[model samples]
Target: MSAVPISEHVALVTGGARGLGAHIVRAIAAHGGRVVINYRRSADAAHALADEIGDSALVFGADVTDKDAVGVMIDAAAEHFGAPVTTVVNNALPDYSFNGDGRSHADNLTWTELDAQLRGIVGGALNTIQAALPGMRAAGGGRMINIGTNLVQNPVVPYHDYTAAKAALLALTRTLSHDLGPDGITVNMVSGGLLRTTDASAATPDAVFDAIAAATPLRSVTTPAEFADAVLFFLSPWSRAVTGQNLVVDGGLVKN
Candidate 1:
């Protein structure tokens, strides 16, 4: 089989406004990939990011969990770029804080909370995959990259709801990879440990960050930019033979 060069394709990043998602958008653009920045609420931030990234980025507002909305968004994205959206980064997330403060332990974890995460992780991903698959089929092939968490492996913090949802997403990612392989669509995930500082991790105390960094072999916490760049690898030709794989990027915290 031949390799698919990502730099020539249009990449759409859901929740590509701030934090890791935003970093992914910037990285793809920097490498000459056209980008579609999708956001559910961060409209202004999304637009500003597109402006900063110059013509390589375009902004769109759509709820990834909503299948119809996602289809419309995909249509608009393709129309705007004058080409099919051949790359998708399912990075949208529900409102969450990784501060370990006010986080529900198993005792207080509610089904409602898990549902929200599921909607964002699993449901959102399902919608995007369904909406974009046809375009990929028409365009010859494509790539799908899902954002995941290292907690699913380490479970350092018992963030029951969020962790559970990501675990489910991992399962879905593998299943989709199998089903989409024949169509030339590669499905995979990029899981990262506690990023140093995103809206979710902003409240995480310095002591926790320091402790994590000290424990990791790299002696430093992961950053959004670093993680984002790793996501780009899957979309690149280098990973044409890799699918149904979870590439964890937490500084070797969990050796595969």
Candidate 2:
């Protein structure tokens, strides 16, 4: 069994001011966990979320891609909550639009675009994991959940750069789970399909959403709150023995 209970966890959620990240933070806080809301440019939203969450939440602005900033944020969060952050939700993403027409064609995509996505996905996860390692080791156990996408499996839109980066993140999630298992830190991923209406998916046409819902077994697009509930499972004691796995929470849009 996991040593820590859900109530005792101090969770740090990157890009946790609005959208899916905010929902994840709300889920954690609702379960009695202290939450650290990390944001890069959404300070107002972050502060508002913290205010709404009250004492159980702390707001911090730090770009996850900046190693030093992430390190500092981890330390500060530990001090604020009197416990090191025991749960990390890597939910940040580079500025992206989901509109297929707006996306760069495969032939037109540049290495720069790909690199930028990789940095936000893989690079951010690397920074937070490394910064929180000692704390998780000391806490006896911890949970790490990386937000992923079902597009990695289907890739129906051919978002080459985005899907490629998330694929890399999945690889990192598995390898790190192996590397960190000895420390009692379980790493896993929760992949969702085009969320009903996250900031990134806001640009998606209504027709696209309708098509996705029609294809899914549930006959509906997964909402942010629904996907966040899956993340909560990874943080709970029931998932103590589950790690290095990716659970797709997309209304069965793409079965793994």
TM-score of 1: 0.97
85-170: candidate 1 lDDT, tens digit per residue: 99999999988876566689868778999999998889999998898888899988899999999999999888888899999999
lDDT of each: 0.89, 0.92
On the 0 to 100 scale, the lDDT of residue 84 in model 1 is 86
TM-scores for every predicted model: 0.97, 0.98
Q: Which residue window of length 10 is worst by lDDT in model 2?
A: 1-10
**Worst lDDT window (10 residues) for model 1?**
1-10
Candidate 2 accuracy as TM-score: 0.98
For TM-score, the strongest prediction is 2
lDDT of 2 by residue, 1-256 (tens): 2956688999999999999999999999999999999999999999999899899999999999999999999999999989998999999998877767779996799999999999999999999999999898998879999999888889888998899999999999999999999889999999998898988788778998999999999999999999989999999998999999999999998998
